[model samples]
Target: MSRKEKTWWWVAGIAILVYCLFPIAWIVSVSFKPPADLNSGGFLPDNATFDNYRTILTGNAKDLFRPALRNSFGICLIATAISCLLSMFAAYAIARLDFPGKKLILSTALVVAIFPVISIVTPLFNVWRQIGLYDTWLGLIIPYLSLTLPISIWTMSAFFREIPWEMEQAAQVDGATTWQAFRKVIVPLAAPGVFTTAIIAFFIAWNDFVYGISLTSTDAARPVPAALGLFSGASQFEDPTGAIAAAAVIVTIPVVVLVLLFQRRIVAGLTNGAVKG
Candidate 1:
């Protein structure tokens, strides 16, 4: 490539990076700013303080933030686990076995994944209320499955298709039972895909706002994203923007850590899954 082309590409990459990271940087800046400086019209706070963190961690807002964090962790973890497990089996079958209506099944999953979530929220709200699952952990988990399961099935199925069937057959020929062969031979090879799917599923469940807001009315089952809307300041007249910013930063930490730690696996899983199928 010409030097001009290389320079333009570098400039474009830097611009995109800044565009993406600016919001996160702003949020982190706001989190550290004192309440007085929150609206000071500065990118960086002049009198940054840990007070916002302190307040949300153990001050007045603790009652709201802590429990919501716990609920988010529990609900997202459970939903991700269930989604990955069910998707693994379903995807394995779809990838390996020649079954009737296979293309139809894949198409259905694609349709569900692309469907507008808002259209079904009303129906789900009424149904959950009737069945007494409203405002419960199970209530959130069930609806989350609908969101996470389809993409997970598609991702895992693509990954499964890349695995060699001969490995499982070799294990079986060695007198290993079907279950043993699957557990020992198939699972380890699929670990990266499973882990990637779990991360994606967890993110979907964690970040969902429409369901989180519409389904739960209280802290009992409301995740962090929904609960953020209900956060109050020290007094009724005060804005909770700083505290909210701090809480947002806190919630974002886990996602950043997950991505940093498993970035290579995530990239491999996504690229391979996209290409192989």
Candidate 2:
């Protein structure tokens, strides 16, 4: 490529990076600002304080924040585990075994994945109320499966298709039982794909706001995103912007850490699955 082309690409990359990170930078800056400086419209506050963090962490807002955090962790983990487990088995079957309706299953999953979530929320709301599952962690987990399972099946199926069938056959021929061969041979080779699917599923369950808010009336099962919407400041007249910013920053930390820690695995899993399949 010409030097001019390289220069333009560099400029474009830097611009995109800034565009993505600018909101996060602003949130972090706002979180540190005192309530007085919140509306000052400055990129950096003249005076910064830890009061917002303190309030949400140890003061008045703890009641809401703590339970919401717990609910988020519990619900997302449970949903992700369930989704990945079901998706793993289904994906394995689709990738390795020829079945009568295999193409139909994949097509159905695609349809479900692309279906508008809002279209089903109202019906789900009534059904949950009738079954008494509304406002419970299990309530959230079930719907999340609908969201996570399709994509996970698609992702892991691609990964599974790339695995050598001979490896499993060789293990079987070596006197290993079918289950033993699968457990001992297939799973180890597919670990990266499984981990990547789990992460994707977890992110979907964790960040869901529509169901989180619409289904739960209280903190009992409300996740952080829904809880953040309900947050209030010291007075009704006071803007909760700084406190909300602090909470947003705190909520983002785990996602950032997960990406930084497993970035290579995520990239490899995606690229390998994409190219091989």
Candidate 3:
């Protein structure tokens, strides 16, 4: 490309990055803004402070925010773990085995993944309440598997497919049972893809709002996203925007840290799985 073209590309990329990051920056700014300056209508707070953070951490909103934060972490992690384990096995079967209805299984997972969450929430709501699962982490985790499993299976299956058959055959020749081969050799090789899928699954479960709100009635199972919506002002007449912003920033930090820590593995997994072997 010409110099001008390269420059334009750089400019365009930077612009898009800024555009995507602007909202996060705005929220961070709002989180630091004093309540008195929240409506001052500037990008940066005139008197930036950690008062909003303090509110959620130790002030009036602590009770609601802290429990919800714990719930989010617990539920998302459990859902991600279950989804990754199941999908890893399922995807391995799909990629390594030639079985009847394999296509059907994949198609069904895709369909479930794309199916609207709202349509099923009402039914889930009724069932959970009836089964005494309402307002519980398990209740949310179960539905979350529906959201995270399809993509996990598809993504992990691709990684499995990219792995050479010789590796498994070699293990078997050395007296490894099929299960042993899979556990000791195949699983370790697929670590990048597994990590990638786990992160994606965690993000999906963490971001879930419909199920969190519909199935859970109290702090017992409420996640950060749902609780953020129901946040009340420090006082009845005041706005909860600052506190909410602070909580949002706190919620986002973990996701940022995760991506930063795993970006290399994620990229390698994605690129390796992009094409079938």
Best by TM-score: 3
Weakest lDDT window of 10 consecutive positions for candidate 2: 268-277
State the C-alpha lDDT per candidate.
0.92, 0.91, 0.93
Q: Predict model 1's lDDT versus the native.
A: 0.92
Model 3's TM-score against the true structure: 0.97
Worst 10 residues of 3 by lDDT: 268-277
As for candidate 3, its clashing pairs are: none
TM-score of each: 0.94, 0.95, 0.97
Best of the two (1, 3) by lDDT: 3
Instruction: Pull out the clashing pairs in model 1.
Output: none
lDDT string, candidate 2, 1-277, tens digits? 9999999999999999999999999999999998889889999978988999998999889999989999998999999898988998899899989979999999999999999998899999999999999999988989989999999999999889889999999999999998898789988898889889989998988889989998898888999999999999899888899989999998988888888888888887877746532
For 72-108, candidate 3 gives per-residue lDDT tens digits of: 9999998999999999999999999999999999999
